[model samples]
Target: MEFDLDYLVQQLPALRAGLLLTMQVSAIAILLSVVVGLLGASARVLRLPLLSPLIAAYVEFIRNTPLLVQLFFIFFGLPSFGLTLSLFWSGVLALTLWAGAFQVENVRGGLAAVSPGLGEAARALGLTRWQYLRLVGLPLAVRSGLPAMLNTGVSLVKNSAYVSAIGLQDLAGVAFDRIASDFRAFEMLAVLLVGYLALVLSLSAAVRLLEHRLQAPFRR
Candidate 1:
């Protein structure tokens, strides 16, 4: 079959829109994951009486399950319980929860890496627990975990393709739809491969730049 470059070019507008939606979902989900990670990690590290076990369970459950199953549960299964979310929000929520699980471990590991003597010294200097965490612990933990967190960010961007399963018009969905209509499977797939590669590569570069900036202080 002759490759249809013209047909692929004609679909650029739709592809662009799909890419925008993909980025939007990934950005929001990553932000939410950071929030969840920080809070979950803190609770676990501090061993908060009631919250620690719950966070641990959440992390384990999400880590153990497939992301697609989680998306399906949010987008499809919730309606049966009289809770319905729009497809976009459902995808975002599912990704957030799924990525947040891994983020929890990344953060927990970072926190654990902090020298125990540092905490003891902070206490000796008459710092309150909250003060020590805020002024000392949080920065160190984030610095240590930045690479893992950025990796999760990249994974989220790539996995955003899964949102297509719920009929969200992300890049994969758009590519699939275009192929179905034009019957140009190779052309469409090639375009998708390029699109995702470009996106992930761009994200990786940005993360590397940010990682360098964050590490500058520690390197001194």
Candidate 2:
């Protein structure tokens, strides 16, 4: 049988439309994950009463488990609790939780890098705790934390493909559907692989740009 480039080209619009959903879910999840990460990281950093241990437990459980299994638990296991969410929302929630676990680790690592000297120096100079953290610790910590967070965000976008197993029509899901419809599994999969590669490469470039703008002059 002859290959049909026209047919795949015709499917581009639908595929791209599917990509939009992936973008939406990934964006929301990243936003939520960052917020959650900040809260969790702060808990650990502040050694907040009993809260820190609970947050640590959450991070450990999520990090130790396979993400796909976690997705299955949310999408499949959640139903047993009589709490149902749509496929899109479920995908978003699952990704947010998974990403939050890693984000917590990154934020803590960065925050830890804020030297004790900075805090001591600020105190010696009569800076208030809030002012010292706001001016010195937070600024430096957040700057150091950005690259790892961006990398994790990239992973979340690519891993959103796993949502397809639960019937969400993310980019990979649509590609799978097209392959089934056209009986061109190899051709369609190759395109899917390249499409993902392009999206990730573009995202990585954007991350580098942001890093450049933030860091300005090279430290070397």
Candidate 3:
């Protein structure tokens, strides 16, 4: 097989552009997931009668169903309700919804790690419910949750590749296009495979650094 390092290098600009889209989708989805995680944790913990039950039901449904199916339903199903979104918007929205489902569990686990004494102390101090949750509970929970949230972030980035199937030119999509254009099938795929492994490995390392920082404060 003839090699073309220069040609591949030239494509880097477009590939980088695609990575930007991947990052955008990831950022928006992560923010949405965090919000969902917080809301789910609060509702489940406080046990608000009606809202609690509804959120519980939502979590169950989301966790049980497949994300790909959910994406299809939103993209294909929403149009039935006269709601249409761009492919990019649809992909981001679908991922956010799916990530939110799994994130509920992360939030619950984090909140559980908060020492009960802290909450009690806050209550004794006459902290308002909002103050107790915002100032006390969330801060403690965030520390305990760091490792798990990082794990979820890794999963979210990997899953973002699926958006390529729906016409979003993410990393995977760019590689696919390269294969079509160059006919360097094996070479293109090998590059793509290694690129993903590198991406995930680098992200996992960053997460480990963050986990270490979180643990540092607790060390005697």
Give the C-alpha miss distance for residue 205 in model 2, angstroms. 1.6
Model 2: per-residue Cα lDDT over 111-207, one tens digit each: 8998888889999999976576667766677689998998899999889999998999988889889877878776677777887787788878987
> Residue 158's C-alpha lDDT in candidate 3?
82
- Residue lDDT tens for model 3, 1-220: 7767777788888778777788788879888988888888888888889988888888899878988888888888999999998888988898888888777778888888888898889999999767887888876777778778777877888888888877789877887888887776665666667766776788789778877887888899
Clashing pairs in 1: none
Sequence-dependent TM-score of model 1: 0.96
- Stretches of candidate 3 above 4 Å error? 1-4, 212-220
How do the residues 44-129 of candidate 1 rate in per-residue lDDT, one tens digit apiece?
A: 88888999999999998999999999999999899999999998999999999999999999998998899999999999999987
Q: lDDT value for candidate 2?
A: 0.86
TM-score of 3: 0.88
**Per-prediction TM-score to the true structure, in the order listed:** 0.96, 0.89, 0.88
Q: For each candidate in the order shown, give its overall lDDT on alpha carbons.
A: 0.91, 0.86, 0.81
Candidate 3 Cα deviation (angstroms), residue 166: 0.9
How many residue-pair clashes does candidate 3 contain?
0
